[model samples]
Target: MRDQEPAPFDAERRLSTREAAELLGVKPETVYAYVSRGQLTSRRVSGGRGSTFDAGEVEALARRNRRDGSGGSGGGNAGGELSVRTRLTLIESDRYFFRGVDAVDLATRHTYEEVAEWLWTGRMVPGITFTAPPGSVSVARRAVEALPEHTAPADLLRVATVAAATADPLRFDLSEDAVLGTARTLIPTLVAALPPRGHDRRDEGPLAHRLWPRLSMRKDPDEASLRALDAALALLVDHDLAASTLAVRVAASARAHPYAAVSAGLGVIEGPLHGAASGLAHRLLQDVLEQGDAAPVIADELRAGRRVPGLGHRLYPGEDPRARALFALLERIPRAESALLAARDIVETTARHAPLHANVDLALAVLTVSCGMAPTAGETIFAVARTAGWIAHALEEYGERPLRMRPSGLYAGPRPPQPLPE
Candidate 1:
């Protein structure tokens, strides 16, 4: 008998069109279009006429397209745009959705500690606990103690981070888990060190609950109010590689330690063009309330060619998701009738005058005032909440290979030959 024919190798084991599209981060239609255009080659099965492309071929096409600035993982290149690269940790999707649940929903149903835990570690359960590495606790404690008496909690945190970084032997460790653990411990410790502002210290719960005494004039926030604030922080915690996050990663790219990286981020955030807009928005609302109408005020400002702050963003075309969420929470407050009216009038007036829509800064400003926090503390609160994201980005940057960020510039100056009179 003739030897049995050797079993034929299976070629269809390679990626299907759908799998190829998923791996390339493009739509299936795009993959099919590529095959149709001969940009990628496909083979038909012996019995069936349908085509299947080799996975290696698809990957090679992606690499070649990326090199030629044609197309790659993300999408089409009709605009001839190079894909913007970033080494920062992105929380857009994962932080937005956890355990198949929305972060906004979890924020409403859970405490700030639980949310922090979920962000720092990927778990939704309560067994996770934060502890500073052996010597880190002592260093952090000493740093906190060394802060000038009566310093605001947020400022104290700034000072303590610098000191803790100086004290830590492992401060150079840029591992994700290490940095997140450090943040978990650092945030709670800094909160605990804040000077008592009022009489709310008797409340029992997480550091955020205890922090109320140091940040609010009200001795006790009603349960509803506390929940709202908690949700607000959760919503504001992170966005994808924001400007401040970019600053942190840039600093880390220079090999700065975590504290220095965060400090750089804070400096960027303190600018009026960034985090301070929220405080400005609150003041603007106050002015509108005092003046009894916003339409004329807004019209006058626009007529004078002055732009109102906290009304717009480069992202979020429709309206800010965080702003909408916070506004919904603010509407629940019992005595916010005047503020609500002012907010409505401002929104209408602003829309009529410009394309800008209300962003999170505007809503956060209103909420800060409603919470009885001092006007200056509004920006400080934003810094505190965003530090988690900054540190995460810094750590991610530290792990990536360093690349100098210098860009070429045009020589616009005229050549100088003759010397000026001495």
Candidate 2:
């Protein structure tokens, strides 16, 4: 749990507004409001990229809010009972399901776009393809290109989504048909928005083929590698109310459009403990391969007091089903042999101490490393694939009563009549 949160702060420590928001259980805008009210002091980074707040001051303000009886995003109701009803996906034992069918089966047996389309409409359309409009692609690419070169892949996707939304006059239409239309077009737009690597860019094929160029620049993937990537996308399309999916559901509950709902989800996916995990795992695997052993690499990580990435999941004690599904596919890719062995070495080395099993992030790292994709490629794939799931959840939330997800916060502060601070 400590690893899931921002690092602990000292008096002089600085935090980005996003970091401040996570600490205070509020949005970044609320963090700025604290600055405006003189409750916190903020400074602009030297390059004028963004503002940073004093960590100690932010901590003090958080304490004050708790003392004043104001609840925050992390709090639950007094009874502590919280659960949301959903028909999209279910997880029990070690396996998961989508719409009453085995998710692993769907991922292995169908194309990614086919799985995504079925998740939205509850019916399969064989040989289905989603294409982005030229106008949407144009605007989205311009917006993405305007960002700093160091912008994360997920951040690029977020910017493209907002820009694409601006071009759609019917963005607010919550009708099933319209949202479905948004789903089909918006996904391809996201894939197309990213700068392509290979010269063989085409908008006409399986989505995995289109996405391949964005993640890997030099190498055109083999047939087996392409299949593995497709399966990976389908396997990750949705999980039961992941943090990002919950954000999407909440935004949908507020009547935000599908694009906005997905944007909200994209916002949550970049957190260290979430979408970035695969990137970390990818780097870790690179180190292991370079070092010629996982033992020392794992030792150094443990010595640094860092939890090993790509090992163990809170939701699964024995094995992660997604990892199992992906690893099986990776075995068929001959080029993945070395990375696969490294992954096995990692799991076996770590298990001697903590009994941790490999999770999907490790499997994803194997694919990326083998295919010569960047460290961030796994996250980009995750963001692209999960967009389908976010839209499905947004569509689901649009059906129920609005604001149904507003969980009550348990106040832990003094009585309201307390004297004002001097």
Candidate 3:
């Protein structure tokens, strides 16, 4: 009667709202609801008597609804699944503790290695040496060799990790403890294998002993400077999930290897807004010393309504814990009189002039420069120490799903279209 109706091809045919709902296991009314809610797109057909939808669009909507936990059998959705939220440990809080010990207390009382052990192994061991499997040593050696000559230990670390991952066929297995052990082992080893300096002296011990030779300027180690460096590293270990840590977690969520994940963290730290703050701090301190008084410099800066570098923080409302700890340590060290006076003057003037307090960066800059470390080394030393935190955050991210961190925003721009030259 209707010119012999053509045979229906199930594979290529568009789906009607009713058919789409049936395929999605939902009622036609639900499909209309989706359209009304702008969750699904539909096309008007036959003078708007009915609507047609692409089969692919229907499938995609079904997948999204399922992911959002809004769709499935019995009118249930996967979107309702409980997602685990990460607990952020900030530096300012009294409740923030590591390995059952307060971080502020640990930074004051422990060496850098001790703090590293605490973070890596979740124990407050007096000393710990991270050990890699016998098979991994050759890979580590090869990685060390492949790095460019004169590379800093920290830079070599970035190269070594990529090499190690490329060499290891079994690197992708997701064992939490195993990966952490590897990180603990690799970090100390990388520190030891950095490009050797002629003036550096070797000493007896594990991590520090191995690192001592690479960082020394004479056959005998500078005990005072080394002690200062140790305290500095311990203090810089972690500072909540700042921007750089967030970047590390994001990369880890993509199932990136530990090295790649840390590399992501390093990239973020390289920016001026984050880890480079210490470098700025170093320069600011140099200016104060060169100008011969901290009050005038800080006072003029405050009067101009410009924020001084190495002061103020988004987290610490009153003061930086690391700053207080490091400053206290610096006070007891011998022959630090000029630097100590400058720091005291700066602190008093800043307190009198502005609400901002000295952060860890300022204190660290004074300690490092006063100990004769090169200006650039301030940031490098920070990276070497903060690696522990980056690895910890990365490990935490690995346990979570590969949920893309796509923050939504309004799409305001030029309006959609008008005939140009009609």
Candidate 4:
């Protein structure tokens, strides 16, 4: 049996570094460099025999290098996921941080304004305030009111964002100072533009207080409820590279105006699988509230091959810290005990059946229920709070390579004829 031509670069086989280097006409060290730069992915051999690369990916990189004239050296991988660096937020050890401050601590101690400042400017500037100009508020309000009667609150927010942008003649300023200034006013403006809940009070507290009447049915929400809403906003200020954050960054990377970036974020967040998860969790909590038993509900959700909304986060191995913090605060509220108990029941039931733990969505859901807010209140809260994060991300992305998020497709269609007759 002749030594049949050593199986020419088997695309199905995972290649060793040396094998990949040989096929790509590069050194083994260069192969390792590609892995480090995220141009290629590597996995350890089962028995710890160094590392291996995906053969198809390696070939793709080689072809891309040849076409681009860069020889697989710099820039992002052609057919690989891009991992952009950001200093805004970090998720480590199941805890989220903005800059260096823990989010849970911020939720408890700092106001939403302070947290937003930290995320926006990397400094915890105290006494910073955000107030939408009365004229801008009027414009946004008119935009919000013009929507169809059944428009969701989140959609109203999106329209308000665009309206505010249109009203501000200076919205094109991309400088950090200008963007931060716009955001400071933009958030409060959006809050004020929400359909008023008919609660007119002289004492205007934090943004949460200003926002409470809009989110809840109560004419005057208690201090504890206001605090919970504030914490929800602060806790959601920023999370590293969420889908919506990525959308904001992508828009910013293309030099879209700040409002456009924010609108992109809102649009992505409107998806049921993202920021709207809390609304589903709200419904689930409603069931728990009415039935007073979570075991059967949990069983039904799992039986239908459905995940319990607001339970389990891929990033947090243990309980979500934000959920824990909010639950603690909610448990302290006088009338929130029943909602808290329902939350606990759902959590316990979820844990026994699966490793699913309560996440931020559940926290928001229970908080809304406790405070007697509407079913869509959690989503409204998420969208508004997450605006701060989206702005922060937009600012960050503005400083990076423009339009770096453009992706390539791996064509899997049938090949065309090489030479067609005219």
lDDT of each: 0.66, 0.88, 0.67, 0.83
Error of 1 at 307 (Å): 1.9
Write the number of the candidate with greater lDDT, choosing between 1 and 3. Answer: 3
lDDT of 3 by residue, 345-390 (tens): 7777787747777888888788756766545566666776777887
Which lDDT value does model 4 have at 172?
A: 91
The prediction achieving the highest lDDT against the true structure is 2
How close to the true structure is residue 138 of candidate 4, measured as C-alpha lDDT? Answer: 86
- Per-model TM-score, in order, reads 0.69, 0.81, 0.70, 0.81
Task: Write down the TM-score for model 3.
Answer: 0.70
**Quality of model 1 by C-alpha lDDT:** 0.66
* Clash pairs, model 2 backbone: none
Candidate 2 — what's its lDDT?
Answer: 0.88
Instruction: Write model 4 residue lDDT over 226-253, tens digit each, in one string.
Output: 8888888999888888899888888998
